[model samples]
Target: MTNMASYTDPTVKHDALLLFEAVDSNPNGDPDNAGKPRTDLETGHGLVSDASLKRKVRDVVQFQVDEGMLSPADRYQIFIRRGVSLNAQLEDAYGALGQATGKGAKADFVAKSAEYMVARYFDVRMFGAVMSTGNASAGKVTGPVTVGIARSQDPVLPIDMGITRTASTQEEKKDNASQMGNKSVVPFGLYVCRVHYQPTRNNQVSEEDLQVLWTSMANMFELTRSAARPDISVRNLFVFSHSTSLGNAPARKLFDSVTIAKVSDLDLPRTSTDYTVTPPAAKSLPDGVTLTTVV
Candidate 1:
């Protein structure tokens, strides 16, 4: 169960590191590049967008709700759900207050509506959103959580393989052979992502919320399996907790404590054992800070 009371406290900061691997899968595809895996042109390393990771977290939340693990009144709704109209969702806020939404609405009404949105939607409270769209403008929130783009530690080679389907949908293809298609994948890759949570942004994130987020990150790959991304897994998760609201040490310094290197000079690594990761020592950690590994 989530501890709802901690959400009101405005003095908690967190930093986390997520290490994951993809085996013969496209972790994230670039629609602009013919659905190929996104990669850095200079470094040749694979890239996974923050949106992709956040979508996985959102899916986990939705799955939990669908399985009756959470209730609608628990204030854990998703605002950016598929096939749902944003205006319709916004209208519900006004409807709850027995009022209409428009340009002429008072400032207090807009503020209250924005607050209501932050309280009702988990994504809004976690990642924030620009609610200025649609008829009902409830303003905006900065949120507290921020996830950076994930990048492979070593260079990766993206391979595009030709695929074919035996069945055809059109009658014109009755005499035709299999339809040709393309599938892109990276032989193997180890990606690392940085995450930050600032309590002062909106003061809406609770201790339980952080716990849920950690769990979501650890299990997102398992829940988001598909042909494009079949063998994605989280290898490590490092969470850095600060005693103060701002932070006790520099994030970059803390991140530098975790180092990753290849075990051998293999042209292409296939397994996680091919790499070695060194996490920070507990005794050497900065004062007023602690580390926790979830995976």
Candidate 2:
């Protein structure tokens, strides 16, 4: 692939920073804690899991395929999607290869099934999967991309508000007019997530795939609005592309170059403007590394 501002070589190493903000929303709710925002009790910092972020990315890609925006739809199908049976999908792979599990057939069937999955599923190629769960087993593939958990820059306050519904579900209890519920929200927060991409010879990750990934990430929240998360958005997407597949600098070094600090004047950050974001200086980057602002 040629060097460019937005699209870079998919085979090379990549480090990215995603800075997003949430206003009056629960970015990610911890069901374990009564559907409240996940947080570090020791530090009060809000948390958003890597799995949640990837699910958003996967949803965006699935939307694209559903709308016929992505051509050759079979190539971008989602494997870990909702309402889909994993074992059934694995069986399809074996059927496609005309192979049945029998004596001495396990190894060959697993190999071909994994390859078939890599070719058909976009998430498997980018985020990887473990398909060795059921009788129809396809070995796992280490994906090229990995996302880290997102952490808020400052401590967040989760406010649980009591809500009421005017109508009751049961007709027998019509006189029990109002029902009580709870809503969880964060007044405001700024979160940063780190992601890395390293191409391996086993999977097929193309330049077009990378482009779609970036596009989906940038708009991950646009079409995913809900009552619980109506004000979440991507504020910045910084991608550092390395010239060589091995990478010219450690990912930590590249990530540290970009700083996100709260403004001195703000006692509590309530909006994105309360914090200042600084991208890595082009001249300060190591040789053979280029930074691109995809968002």
Candidate 3:
């Protein structure tokens, strides 16, 4: 874990490019369409939402805390958590300070509460949040780290297959019977996601925070296992750190420098080995910028 104090710098900006692959797994499910894998209707390309990716990162951080890798008072709490009420958390925040958790709370108090939330929640500090619920409103913080939606390098084939279980859960089954179910999967896909860190946004994301973010992305799929997603892995992670907060080069240009292509002979690709990745040369990088690759 990186020292928490290291993230207080407010003038360091960063851009990252990630390449990952999924095999026979549903990376992101679409609730609008019966929990199927999300896809582009016209192009058939698989889609993984930025929220989904961020959730994975958050899960990793939470897991670290659970494993005692982080301390309780480390100010790395999770704001958007599962099985927890936002209002309840907000009330607790005010209660801790012996302040009224109501809409009529003083403006300065609200501002202070918001700062408290930022200091307590790692996600809030790095990704920002809208801490307004009921009588308690801590306002909003625009997180410094921004993640873009991930898309496959090529169009993916979504396959729906039927499954069955011989054992039934209910006592109503007198005899051994089978349970029927269906699941969706992508045969294979390599996805690309972009991440940006704006130092001027919150001045909360430090070099250590960025390292944790990278580690989270690199190992997210491996640690978060499920029947629906079992074979996803990170293939490449490219980071571009600029010396100045404003940055020296365009983000798109930096992204365009890296190229990924499938093997010319393979009609259908099933793994990361089937593709070739071309990263830009270090000398080609713009002045006042450094690149790091973690694969």
Candidate 4:
């Protein structure tokens, strides 16, 4: 349902990454209020607005798509939460499934798995964008997006149904609970990474700059493999920037904003049932997908 993710980087371990083009920035949700939308934090701090986050997520998701981790038809879900509560839930509930299944009884199995997945999900630890107000010809007049499900300035980066992660000793069955095995905790996920976005310059971006950013970020995302969608069409693609001033701010380079957050402090993450593997089970695509097998 989107443009395929594109990348030419080569040093990533495909199997190690869990989240495909994910993110994990600071401030959890909105600043002022930690995790809670009500509390107000300082200015020019915290993660970019929800809209900014979505754009970045989409673009990064595109990276995975471009890399062939996922297909154009692959479903991608983006969550803009205030914390990693879901991650805790998965760890607390099903974190030990691997141990019981003989995957090894390490005290830190849960933690390690969580860490790997979070890292994959949040491939980019940083995101920056130029700041400028919307101009009649181009640029965005929109400020930071509110951190809730409201009338977004744009579509949710135009994705298919969201993809939820689940782990299992067996394959996942929707109707029969019997097929579901010790899979309680989601093995991997895709979260947030660094997002450098800002108002568009009249639907414009520098090709050289875009290429460089993609080339670098692609390599970084590759580091976390097992979870990357491996398809460019699935990842979100776009440019982002911030405004240095309000009311028709002029977008400029290096005027990007900064946000930081801890994965443990938030209430996000998902758990899914396990699914056995076979060539057929490897991917799910809509009828419209036209994928090129990765060499």
Candidate 5:
């Protein structure tokens, strides 16, 4: 906290960028590191299984029928829907504690303050700067491509294949995507990288805080791609955190269920890991974790 960086300082911003780089790279730099499984984490990468994919597509179709085909009042109504959440404020002594709801709360500063704090805590963007520049290099040595057959009657072609690890050349990226009626181009990509923390007013990161962060992200990956095809494959998904600003998840068994083994299998960050933050204290964490400060 002594040598803290300010938002306006360009030097601090540059360090911020560097922090992102370090976090994305494996904290141990061990390319062979494939994390174990978490009872709390998803079993496999995406919902790229047989049964679930059909169900998801069916749901989408059903939604179109139910709402898209109906009129405004008959199909759906937007006015009845609620807006953002609000918080309640409590003061010392046996005073009044107001119940605030909706975007615009009462004329209470405490209520607004509480609401803002809650929002910042839950916002994903607060964690780090998200990168849009995905892996565009072609001819990555994808270990194997498996596109599922949609209807079973007409088998889909192999949209993805395991290009040998040593087969990578600076040739054009084989955007050569293809598939039969069965094997539709499924959402597939390499795990470029991800971040663990971002610029924020607070710096104190506790073990439990990191546990919650990973757990939430794990849940999100499942929730987001709940409807992927069986053939689809999620090459990589990871989180990057600054070594100095890393949070310690004392109780979390942060191991992924599945990972693309064989080095050069994918043009990803190389590890199945999204990225890792430099834990605040690694020495004390081997056996158990302890917090030095909390902001």
Candidate 6:
């Protein structure tokens, strides 16, 4: 009894399980630890920050919008792109509406600017933004989507592989003709992430917006390929859509229904086949909830 209808409806609450894998890649680097692969010191489990995953999602949406793959193309503009000025973008809202930015008009200006931002930028509508900086101050918006950090199912081992560059920066250095460096990577790891969507009136998340979010997540790694993470990919995306906006069951319960365990006698998993991933049985779901497999 899994119903696909209303799953993308913004009025209902949704919870998603994102399973992705990395083979010989650095999924996320810790700047605090000299760009090493992020890990938990106590358990040695691989960790990928929610911010890193969101950035990839954003990049995916932006790429699709730029290529005219998504409809209503003007509304899917990305606000947090590199080399773009947030203040400048915020200021444009006032300019577009021809609104004044004086102290007397500050409250209205902020409200209108925030509304304008929500309508124009896809990320602002879905991920929210803090636009209260610089000359134009749009009030802070709480997004409908919340992404949790991704953690490996088992303990991971991150190693640094030594490499050397053929050319040196300085031509005068005759004896030292090459420079050496190390790349941090995990041999293999399967990570699980949770993304929750709770819609509200303020952000105005639509069904089409949810489509963009889901599509972006499914193709996040493919569009964001890099030398350090060429083998990363999305293995599964399990979406749970509630019939009501308040939700029919606790998210944790739904998440628990889907179990993941290592195959018997197989240790040190190197591929997805090494583990057994089980989604919830059709009858196991709570009332007014539907589970949809998107990948």
Best by lDDT: 2
Please write out the lDDT profile of model 6 over residues 181-265, one tens digit for every residue: 8999999999999999998865478778898898899999998778788899999999999988899999999999999988877
lDDT of 1 by residue, 259-282 (tens): 898898978889899999888888
- The predicted structure with the larger lDDT, 4 or 6, is 6
For 204-252, candidate 2 gives per-residue lDDT tens digits of 9888899899889999999889999999999999899998789999999
Window of ten residues with lowest summed lDDT in model 5: 136-145
lDDT of 3 by residue, 166-209 (tens): 88878889485788899999999999999998876446555556
For all candidates in order, the CA lDDT equals: 0.85, 0.89, 0.83, 0.27, 0.25, 0.89
Q: What pairs collide in candidate 6? A: none
- Residue-by-residue lDDT tens digits, candidate 4, 100-219: 322333546544433333222322111212211111111112321122221211111211223433543345553443332221111222232323233222212223223334444434
> How well does model 3 score by local distance difference test?
0.83
**Where is model 3 more than 4 Å wrong at Cα?**
1-10, 71-73
User: Residue 281 CA error for candidate 3 (Å)?
Assistant: 0.8
TM-scores vs. true structure, each candidate: 0.94, 0.96, 0.93, 0.21, 0.28, 0.96
Task: Give the per-residue lDDT digits (tens) of candidate 5, residues 1-72.
Answer: 212221112111111111111111111111232321101122222112322332332233334335564233
Name the Cα RMSD for model 6.
1.5
What's the number of clashes in each of the models?
A: 0, 0, 1, 92, 18, 0
| Candidate 5 accuracy as lDDT | 0.25
Task: Give lDDT: candidate 5, residue 146.
Answer: 15
lDDT of 1 at 290: 79
Cα error, residue 28 of model 6, in Å, equals 0.4
Against the correct fold, how does model 1 do in TM-score? 0.94
lDDT of 4: 0.27
